[model samples]
Target: MSVHDLWDGLPKAEIARRRQKNAVRWQRRWRGPDINPTTGRLAQHKQSYSDNQKPQALLDEAAQIQSPHQQGTRSSSVTVGTLLDRHLAAKADRAPKTIEADEYHASVVRDTFGDRVLSTIDATEIEIWSQRAEPAASSRKKQLELLRAAIKRGVRDNLVGVDVTEGLVVSLRHTERPYWSSQELRAVVDAASSDFDATMFRVLGFLGLRENEMRTLRVGDLVGNQLTVRDSKTRAGIRTLPVPASVLPSLVELAGSRPKADWLFVSPRRPGNAVSKGYANAALTRAVGGANAIRIDPIRRLSAHGLRHTFAAIALSEAGGNLLSVSRALGHARPSITLDRYGHLAPAGLEPLMALVDAFAVPKAA
Candidate 1:
């Protein structure tokens, strides 16, 4: 007898076991409204996802799967968009900045894999996702991170059989590091038509202050030709960065208002509110050409933080890679962050310090 007949003859408990197996193995099929199979007319399916989903999209995915001619097994899937939505839901409890980053990553994933399904995705898909857009290395990294995070969620949900993203990493072959040339810095400073922006650019480019530190600098903190900045990223960012006499004049202008303990970068929107990073950036662009205002290494463009990188590079390269000292000046929580980032600036590190002994050893010929 056929299995259907045999099942009919089975005991109640056995029948329950068979039904349970079927449900567990059930793969939904998508059959859109019938058309003249000959006419090829397209039809729309109904909406889906309790609040942020669509059933028609899910149903349409089911339509593409075909059972093996000689077997009953089938492949299943969940959509990229669906997975992204779940990630978005996860951000509800995360920090504001973290939520922002996750959203941006989700935006990239949706743009790249809007129609791809989770079951069909693989390392190849991730590789393409990283390169197909061919933007910046940092952007690609964010996209890859988002995909990996979603795949991790899949593993947690039992939606996919394996963590296909196990060893995947964003390609760093063309990753551009951010640094600014002295001439470019001058060009932006000279180009500054607005007092506020010109002053901001000089502070960032010369002093190497981040958006937060730039916004926080004050008149009282300026003493003995050094500016003390309080770091908010960690308690350790509190630091003193001595200024080149050239940067002093601009610091004077920024602190002229003698604004309260309030942020120097404070937004005009509210007298006391922190100045918007966007406004400072926009002003910078206005003062300098868009390209000049943004930092770019030899080949790529970088944002405000690039100015910070440029400063670090200049300091380390000039000082022969004094990281312990640079970390203190840059207000980093730990010296390790400095080493990881600018260790290469210390090309001298490649040659063992013991190599220095060769120079010091009595110059026998002299």
Candidate 2:
């Protein structure tokens, strides 16, 4: 029989059984809500190479946190927009920039989930959205913070009975990267294309400056030998980062021709302004492609923030994980952020690594 007749040879019962199995297979693979094709805005996690195929019959259930145990059925009264508007009004007392960021999220949330009842969002959607963009660990972390904030507000306002993000994993534990050995630094910094960009990298990689701190670094910020960061991301972000002794000679060389507000690394297009960190990051990614010029830990991918992370890691490894010194270097509000991100910099050797099994298995040495 031809292909058409061969398909018809399957009995009606067999075809139904095959269709049912296919539906289950596809449904199991869906990671999130179906996305809108026109917007490229994801309502769900789509497979990377979807062929416009969907199993229409079996849309797996919406994710939910609480297994309803006679607690009231989901009250579908509140739209996602309603919750967001309420959040804006309640956050009126926060910092303007913070309020502005929330407002931006509010706009996107409204467009994305505006019509859906607050009840419809569940645990699975939460997981997929946070990690969807394959955002940098830092971005994933902040997005989770935002999600937790919104959910907490929802619970506070009686929109939900529980914060569903309690089980969320915001960032995976990552290995601490070794600071560049002198040889590696020379390979990258002294290479033909990297001379100037290397200067910018040192300010961040050595000094633990935030992206903005580096972008806004001014001719006036450098005095004699140190880069004074009096105002950084927070009130605590204000602290001077010592210039590496190795780099002072070059910085002094570059100092001869400069303007008062001229950024240390000027944006190519904007001329007088600082290089946008995002743009700088992209350019550097392209520049470093397969170029083994810098030797980071093989497992640790290098990025602009990796520079800051490496600085803290080096400080801790060189100084026995001194939280106090690293905190001051990073201008963190508390030593905790410093310790959490880079404390593992100095391998606690094998003691802590083996503690998991040792704790449970070690009988008293009677």
Candidate 3:
């Protein structure tokens, strides 16, 4: 038989099946209550792609455009905006600063694809969006993480089909954390415009409290030589630290007879409020300016947080490389976190390394 006549041996149904298998390719069937393209009503959706189209990609696109919601379900479709709103509402109990951060990060997502159907968001779309995001790499990474967390919660709540942010990664450029040297710190303290400014410097450099923590300090928090951290960024940060003798007298004198609830570092501009971050920065700048004017060894301008780091560095060096002590004093959640940032600065000795080997050493055969 001729090539054309060979098909005549088979039934018409088989011939049609072979033609379908060879001539026309169908994308994987996506069964969902999508809007029918032919009839703008909720029905089973079907679509075909050209030879140049990827079956998987076409299927994904169809799914996103068609059935973002469940079939026959009376629930409203969820969007990125809805997810972020829900996420924010759920975090009503978090600290105000934490909530503010969440909102800031959430705004980036909201501004980009907030109205987009949450179910339609895929990893590829997010990755592309992240690349175009205007925030610095670190800030953008935080924003991405916030969006991922919201989507993850949506999935757990059955509001989303999948977590599209599963494997997304944002690379951050590492920069050295600036800190003040001991001599620089002492010069800044000596050059302080007022006794209170000098005391603030001492508190930050000796206590290792964060700038905010220092600003929020209260007289009642200090008891003899013990200082209590009542409020902090994390629960681990709420710790009591032994007051260094060097700063004790200054703190006691600063406390005077102020009420327990009164702020230790009251705002210079706003009397009722705690010291502003701007004031902290300006104080450091002024002190550095004074130190540079007369000193042979000029001081580098540093932020208030740099004093906290200086405290960590000093503690690690003076405490015989006691990582635990430094970590606890700095209110780090874990010793590993402390080690990651300052481990190299720890005093190195063969004795500590040899001790580890000695612990596992076997007695020589007698």
Candidate 4:
């Protein structure tokens, strides 16, 4: 019969009692035949242990009798470095950019715990290491999470018994990126030193494309009113976006006379290559801070990503807070992700809902 069949119709208390009795019996059997080697007589096993000895202590004593190798191979075969290497190797199919970040995080893990055996590292050691690492809250969290994942792989591979990074918490300091108003975006674009720089800033603010996505655009990607993003960070990012009417003229002017295979934005130094992300960012900073344009304060200096936030803010406002429309336009993987990041920028219509709740209230007996 199956184990479930054996338990059928038995009272829970009775089942528990029988289970404990069987466990004790099995423990005795596992301890081996009790006949004394000298007398060939059954010895009193219970009487041999002091009353103060705990059940776990007795189990530990039993474990000590077994060969260490038979108990576990984790200590002998698995080091922190070994588990990290295996984990990284298993992620060979991940994107090169993703793998590069993983390698950097793996290097941090190796520097902290490389020589230690997997079995010897525990939660306390992990917590202590995190405290000493002194990385930013987010970076610390990622490193610990990566270590936890590697150790979990070790557990699945039977190289380790427990995950050491479990239950460790890292508190992050919350900071929001500064977004731009419509006037601020216009001011920055107007300040651009060249037509190319102005068009690039307008594309970022209008289309909400990532820096890398903008750089990889080819002349063929732009049709009449639509711009196709062929390469992106996620599959959801590959999408066709409608070109904003305001930026359409500039985009058309920029693409004029170029072959379909030519890059939409080529570097001034290199005829065929796109502008480097670093140079684009530096140019943007200089343009925004230029004396002739609206002077951007040091605190509100726009980064390339800040322009994307500016797009989200303007799009949500113009769409009357339609999250899905804004999310789709921005090529976010999910509407929920868009909400989490940019919810504050959306219009708050909660006052009407609150009024409805107030109407249902009954008067108190005064």
Candidate 5:
């Protein structure tokens, strides 16, 4: 019978199936067959010749066509581990410190959800995991943020259909940090063991600089009493501060022997490089301990950051409770931010305002 007559005799489903089979057969024939139909063996020789003859672009396109799972819609086989690997690989270009932090966060995520397919991890599952994890508020927030960022990248790469982190509430609790008083700060400075430690303590206390910023300081940054902070945590943090007279001699003494291009706080073990955070932390801890021995209420929680808070508290008092000056001194993006953090330390309400009012008010009839 003719092919048309045979096709006409077949049921609609059978016809459709035959048409699909014929189409596949024609495609294989046109592509020189990937498999031998009779032997059911891969046509290795044919594939080798095809691969050798094909251009790189054509080969890539063909690979994409063969493996549709990697491209458009999310695939059920892609797991959280796979997405994290891809995300971290992309994050290699970020700052080393930032990459290290990302790796730490990724480890936490991998421990929880690594094996689960990306699409299978829904909001409910994430919420449950988060509740079970019960990490500190700050750490929990960072972990969720990292996961959300990685999932977003997965979505862009077509590995995930939806961002499960969406609508999941990761509430962050505000933890109060301890602020040091002037006496406590002075005690720490006096307790510093080495000249370098003493200088570092004085500079940090006077300038309100972050530990990283302090470590990255170059000798040239000190221009007379004005110290130019080039590297900082934020753009607002890149500022120049008038060095307090108390710390000026220490800073000048430290820089007096070093070249202008040299790091102000060079690592003793690895000369020419900036000091490590661990060294700074240890030195600060020792200084705090020593200071505690001399003071009535020993400041047990005085970190490097606490020194900045101490500067803020002292500056706010010295500025007559002016938050604007204190904010500028602290390199805060806004006075509101300074107020939010140090407003409690600000001079009591209405005193300055009442003083202003008194200056303008007419003398009451005596």
Candidate 6:
């Protein structure tokens, strides 16, 4: 019998109502056909769980009881598909965007190893699968990460004996972000024809805000010498940054008695709207072209993001190789991310550690 058979041909609304009502009740009861097909009689099936069991877990258990075949018998062994279901169930309360991303990642995993037993997956097989799975490194890495998470859930539930991915390592093979030097940035700023272009470039180079974040800035976001990011793509992206003294006048002038809720950078095409990405890009393109015309060393063509990178590169040098300051400024969720991207720019030498070792040594002669 299928799980829907327990509903006894009830309409969708009634089934939903009963499911909602049964969600809180301790004993889950459902009616289905008798074990023998020839009996032609209805049999009631009931199951109970402890109060400590979560509602979702209880629902999954009820599903197993109603239709073992449909739910895939858990009595034998756990499969990758089962672990994925558990993983997704645990994240039901997350944001919709996050859930969507998880679903996409799960689909990528299911296509390759959904039916495989969790216990049988080992590091060697995982490594081989990763190599042949997907050609795109980033997508391949995300798929492996999702599979690893599912295996972790299986291990936690005691369905799997050991974690095979514990010792596995995968490299992302990232490329360095493009950025401009101080002179190139100065040239671009000098070449800007209007105050609007100059201020936009200053914000990108000096403050290191993302294009979206900068465009969405409001008059109220700037208070005194600090700016608060109210809207961002990630939680870490919402933060307050100290505006540079050099750019304060231009920023204040740009804001210029506008209402608190008004977009800091108004769109010319669409009234009462924030600056669009195309407009921002076109502005940067004009500045780069003008800078190239005047300078002996032509500035490389790069996106607005390169200006943010320029800020990080310069700030790291100015802050005495402090990754935390630069990471926080860049709105990175973790300092390790900043170190991973810009650690090569830090001064490399073991002289201080060597001096410490010498200090700990005993007298050479007595």
| Best by the lDDT measure | 3
For each candidate in the order shown, give its overall lDDT on alpha carbons.
0.64, 0.60, 0.75, 0.74, 0.73, 0.75
In model 4, which residue pairs have backbone atoms overlapping below 3 Å?
A: none
TM-scores for candidates 1 onward, in order: 0.45, 0.46, 0.58, 0.56, 0.51, 0.72
Q: State each candidate's clash count.
A: 8, 1, 0, 0, 0, 0
List residue ranges in candidate 3 displaced over 4 A. 1-77, 186-198, 210-216, 229-240, 256-296, 312-366
Best first by TM-score, ranked: 6, 3, 4, 5, 2, 1
Worst 10 residues of 1 by lDDT: 66-75
| Cα misplacement distance, residue 291 of candidate 4 (Å) | 9.5
User: Per-residue lDDT for 175-195 in model 4, tens only?
Assistant: 666788777788878888889
Best by TM-score: 6
Q: Give one digit per residue, the lDDT tens place, for model 1 in 102-169.
A: 77878778886767876677777677667764677767876777777776775676555566667876
- Candidate 6: where are CA atoms >4 Å away? 1-76, 93-95, 156-159, 268-271, 317-321, 333-343, 346-366
lDDT of 6 by residue, 1-366 (tens): 112234557798987897877643344455574563566667778654323233334465456646747444453466677777777767666656667877897887877777787666668888887777456766676677777887787667655666777766556666788888777887888888788889999998988998888899999989999989766655677799999898899999989898999999888778899989877678889989998887787888878888888888878755454778788888886676677678766655788558879987958776
TM-score of 1: 0.45
lDDT of 3 at 196: 84
Q: Tell me the tens digit of each residue's lDDT in model 2 across 1-366.
A: 001112347788886886676532222234335666878675444221111122221121122223454235434445555555545555666656666776665565555566677677887787887676665666566656655666677777455667767788766566555455434434544542455677766666667777777777677777888777865655567787668797777666655568656666678678776677686576456445434544464322366776677567656665454678779888886675675666666556677658777888888787
Which pairs, if any, clash in model 1? 48-53, 48-54, 48-55, 49-53, 49-54, 265-275, 266-275, 267-275
lDDT, residue 30, model 2: 42
Q: List the residue pairs that clash in candidate 5.
A: none
Higher-scoring candidate on TM-score, 5 or 6: 6
What is candidate 1's CA lDDT for residue 331? 74
lDDT (Cα) of model 6: 0.75
